[model samples]
Target: MAQFDVSLVLPDTLYHGSTMGAIQGLRIKPINKEFWKDAKDFGAGFYTTIDLFQATTWARKPVVAMERLNKGTDPSAMVRSLPKDQIPVVAVYDCNSNLYTDNIILHDYRGESRAWAQFILSHRHSSTVDNCLCLNEFGWIHPHIACGLMADNDTGQIIEDFRSQGRDIHNRDDLEWFWTQIIRTREGRRLNGLELGDQIAFSAKL
Candidate 1:
């Protein structure tokens, strides 16, 4: 069936797709903010997944992003000590189930919805301080553990396409203008089920 981190200390199994080769040490350190300048689906964190296929898809990202002008590494990845030319790899972290739960806030977005779409936009296009729960003492969204759909890496053109039609994604009118258009693509797959891939972003925080 399905497995949840019973102890809440960690998950029974979380897969990480990367090109960093063999991960050193037993610890999982999320990439630094400087590594990625773009807005992420769940802010910036160590993104993983319970779905094997999804993780496999992630394995392809590092490679594809490297060749493409858009990402392919984002150029500034050097600050994070990430390699530029390497094969994407999916590192399966088979976490052990234990018994411990406290001071952990996890927001799981089961399937796509208006709230989910809006949440992504808040992290990408703008900031929603009130809705953001991962804020720091300074009221900045440091982000928390968020489990949701993988952000569509190819959203730029989609945004531009809508813009050509004079549709502003940031517009709240016309029933959350942004969501109406996005749901028409991969993110909209929620209507049936996960068609692209899934992910769970683990924050750098302990």
Candidate 2:
């Protein structure tokens, strides 16, 4: 199983599929337009960031789906950070900009995923996200499999059911493989070690 340590910037909620024995450290730091950039370091190394904007309207499955469907976009910040030659990242067209989304895996409770999945699936392309989740071969809720979401009981049931039907569910195993690819591929890691002074690093012994 792929081990993970997630740092939560917001309190009062837990992400799905935290590692089987993962240790999550929570820090309550209010983020606004003025504070968003400062929050980047709070999510170093295999972590997720929950912006204050996200916290306001992030709940509800259909809302996420519709947002991706109607206005999904990849932001300049993420695009500028991505190394070339990786699987193409989807960018949604907004009023005057793009938003980059890294969450492609399904939600824990609502089974939601990144916006790209629907786009790829809708376009009839085999979604890399689907393959990654299905082929992981670990328990349904492994962080590698679940990606940015938690692995709650409902999420577990959906995964098992999908597995029984021979469905592709990317789990922890797939995430490990994906990370391996990122680490090994030249283009994928091309940006590695670049002096991004704004990035934050936080870790604690479990």
Candidate 3:
């Protein structure tokens, strides 16, 4: 089993006390699949980033903006209105990759191969393509993992544009080209694997 020792950082500035409480209490749960389905890029699962800066941005997202974004409404203003704080704490975990054997799907977009790009587009645009089915066909749903093309305003807009246009409206070459550029600097990673404990170590506020 590939073992990973990683840290999940939650910014107190972005989340309410109760939300932080939940994380501290180990009560945080993955977003439900139904709601996650419409979520940009990969459907719902616990999301994390190896980059602390990226994670800090996620943790600092305002609740109202998050709600609006999830509802497909533009929340650019709301996002800008949110205050940035430095009170971020990290939750560390030791993960057993073996536990992900039948449960995890990796999108290794960092490579030159176009496979990850194709899979992302197909998963996003194909009405008949069920991510659950994709997971099951490969194995079982231990969890969800998206390696490349980190979700952000630019990438999110790309996804929205393609989704609004419908898969057939755009040429595959253009889509493939766009994705190739997006994943160029992305890293190979996974999320929601089997965590060994409820509480590992929490980093002091950064």
Task: Please list the C-alpha lDDT of all candidates, in the order they appear.
Answer: 0.57, 0.26, 0.40
lDDT-better candidate, 1 vs 3: 1
Ranking by TM-score: 1, 3, 2
For residues 1-206, write the lDDT of model 1, one tens digit per residue: 47787433456888876665435422444443333335566665667788877777767765455546554455445324445435556677766534434465677776767667766765654333223333532244554577766545355665555556676434666227656555555545333347536777766554
lDDT of 2 by residue, 1-206 (tens): 56655432322332211211112222222111222221111211223322323322222233344445656554443434434432122111111112323432232211223222222121121313223222233233312211232211222233344445554324445333322332222334322222111111211110
Q: Model 3 over residues 4-108: C-alpha lDDT tens digits?
A: 555423322212121343353433442223223333344434444444454445555556446655786556555554454323344333344444335233433
Best by lDDT: 1
* Most TM-score-accurate candidate: 1
TM-scores, all models, native as reference? 0.63, 0.18, 0.46
Where model 2 places Cα greater than 4 Å from the true spot, the runs are 1-45, 52-115, 118-153, 168-206
Clashes of 3: 1
